[model samples]
Target: MDHWSSLSMGKNVLMERRERADAARNRQAILRAAEELLRRHPPEQVSVERVASAAGVGKGTVFHRFGSRTGLMLELMTERARELEQAVTEGPPPLGPGAGPAERLVAFFAAVAALAARNGNLMAAHEHAMVTRKSAAEQPREANPIYLFWHRHVSELIAERRPDVDAGQIAHMLLGTLHMEPVASQLRAGQYEGLAASFAAIVRGLMGEE
Candidate 1:
């Protein structure tokens, strides 16, 4: 159209793009800070000010970006959990489509074992916070999305492998039995090898095979 109209449209596009870019950058900063805190210490120990310092931003910026400490923790863990879930459900893996139940179960446990060993602090921190005070809504539901994802994945495996067995019960048992809490806690305290093997052995038993 006319030059004035074209200039106005161009200006609007530039402004929108700039806002999106800034939002992305701010998100990255917050996540980076959270990740750094996760590496050095648990989430419980990492305050908004600490995260702000780590992210090279103001405390106000962090709060404005994430709204609250819980909000920031959720954002951080959500990214990681969603990645793992997608990997199991959709990404290439023994857990991915086409793999047999036994293989998928084993693979899923293996992945959990690794995640636990690696992210023990983050897990413990979230747990400690949750226990100190329960939220009314529990917006995300059931501790964390990772556990729910694991429940679903393991149940599906059971359904495939042993149609006679109660998949729901199996899911519950696995949720309680081979969960990350105990294993990861032990791992955090420096019992890595045994816990890792124990996880594999447990998975083997679950599969009803050697």
Candidate 2:
């Protein structure tokens, strides 16, 4: 199983509990196998057959568990999301429900950027996965949970300050700047320290404040 590829909550929920449980167990086994392989072997050398054999299953189980190598990667992304959600939901103060919306918004993006930098391949993988699906049938995964989390905070913050402006659009605009890689790269290149200030100013401007 690819760590990030096959984690489809919606797809699994439809399964009978037994099937779901079995799938989950198999999924875990596959992930463990992949993790072990990653520690010892290069990714390209770790084939689906190798993964299945490591997990004590047939080669087809690899295909069933994750549609393909790409599916495996997507599962990994989902794992990352689950881990991040668990961290913020269970671990500490700044990330939990008690933080103010504006503060939370800042904390969220900085954390995401740091996570992206650490994972290094995550953003590129995500863009690839998303672009692939955009060409296929149906909506892309409601993949917004991570993105929406911050957008919601921005919306709430705007609502507090503006009362009348469309918090939705304002939230999109502010978070758009924060999460946009081009803007982030510019900020990282020492092009400006003003990005944060500019973000704040835009949010404030949306609220009709100077």
Candidate 3:
């Protein structure tokens, strides 16, 4: 319309773009700071204030972006798992496509176990923070995005191989065993060895393979 109006609209659009870019940069900086803190100190020691200072942002910014430490941890978990999720969605077989359901299931569980083993501390911290949040306000574990993705994938694979049984319930049962605390404990105790084979045998049994 008018020249002045067009100039104002362009400025607003530019401002919005800059805000989004700044938010993205702040998010990555916070996550990286939190990760380094977790590596150096225990989860309980890593606070939002500490992360804010490390990321060179104000504490209010961290709280505004991630409601609480639990939220921050969950976002970090999602970030770390993003690559694995992408691989499952679009990468090669058996982790991706082009493989039987049983094989894919096995690969998926093994990959999850490996991820957990590598990030045992982060997993444990996330679990601890989640528990603390749950005590104050009930938050359903099923609502977690990462868990939902894994559950959906497992359910589909199970349903493909065993149409009679309740794939959803079976997927839940299997995922329960792979939860953060138990998997972290197994990793800590050095008992995580041979986990892949164990997972494969269990998957084959569920698939009714010989």
Candidate 4:
């Protein structure tokens, strides 16, 4: 190709790369801002304009990146869910690959409880929004990918230790105890006193002296 044409093509490629990098940076900023805002305030107060202002991006940029408020919240939920899943599947011991099933199960519940403690409001808001949308009404709480992953993980752990027991039912029961309302209630009542100890006790009972 001609020298001018080659230079123009190179410039275009560089511009595209820069644009992609900027978009990624903006996305991260928006997520961070949204997370911080949601942590400090309720979901109704966390508007796109507020998030955009906190993120230092134009309001239109937030919509352009996430399509809508519901879309943004779903993206955040997906990100947090995937991060927790990775920690349980691939990260350090107890929660990850290196520990025995019993130990891993204990760690798994603790991690899930912590996750719910941190993001329970955000998760509930996201679920409510999804349920409100006509197209998403059929997707129940059980259909949540994070919940599915947790259920399967707990069932596998139960199966490993108690082959004769009904692992799936027990798994659901264990997960129910870790639900946001229960955990929040426990926190309110005990001020998080012996939280780990309580989880250990439950784990022992569930795993049956293992």
lDDT scores of the candidates, listed in order: 0.72, 0.60, 0.87, 0.79
Task: Pull out the clashing pairs in model 1.
Answer: none
Q: Indicate the worst ten consecutive residues by lDDT in candidate 2.
A: 134-143
Ranking by TM-score: 3, 1, 4, 2
lDDT of 2: 0.60
Over 4 Å off in model 4, which ranges? 58-60, 81-83, 137-141, 184-198
* Model 1 residue 190 CA deviation in Å: 6.0
Query: Order the candidates by lDDT, highest first — what do you get?
Result: 3, 4, 1, 2
Residues 42-88, candidate 1, lDDT per residue (tens digit)? 66788778888888888988878876676677677677777678787
Query: Candidates' TM-scores?
Result: 0.80, 0.56, 0.90, 0.77
lDDT of 2 by residue, 1-210 (tens): 665556675456657677978888999998777656655664455567887889898888878878765566556656766766676667565555566555545555555555544443443444444655434542343344666655565577667766777888866775566346886555434444345455545544555555
Instruction: Tell me the TM-score of model 3.
Output: 0.90
Q: What is candidate 4's CA lDDT for residue 178?
A: 54
User: Candidate 1 or 4, higher lDDT?
Assistant: 4
Candidate 1 — what's its lDDT? 0.72
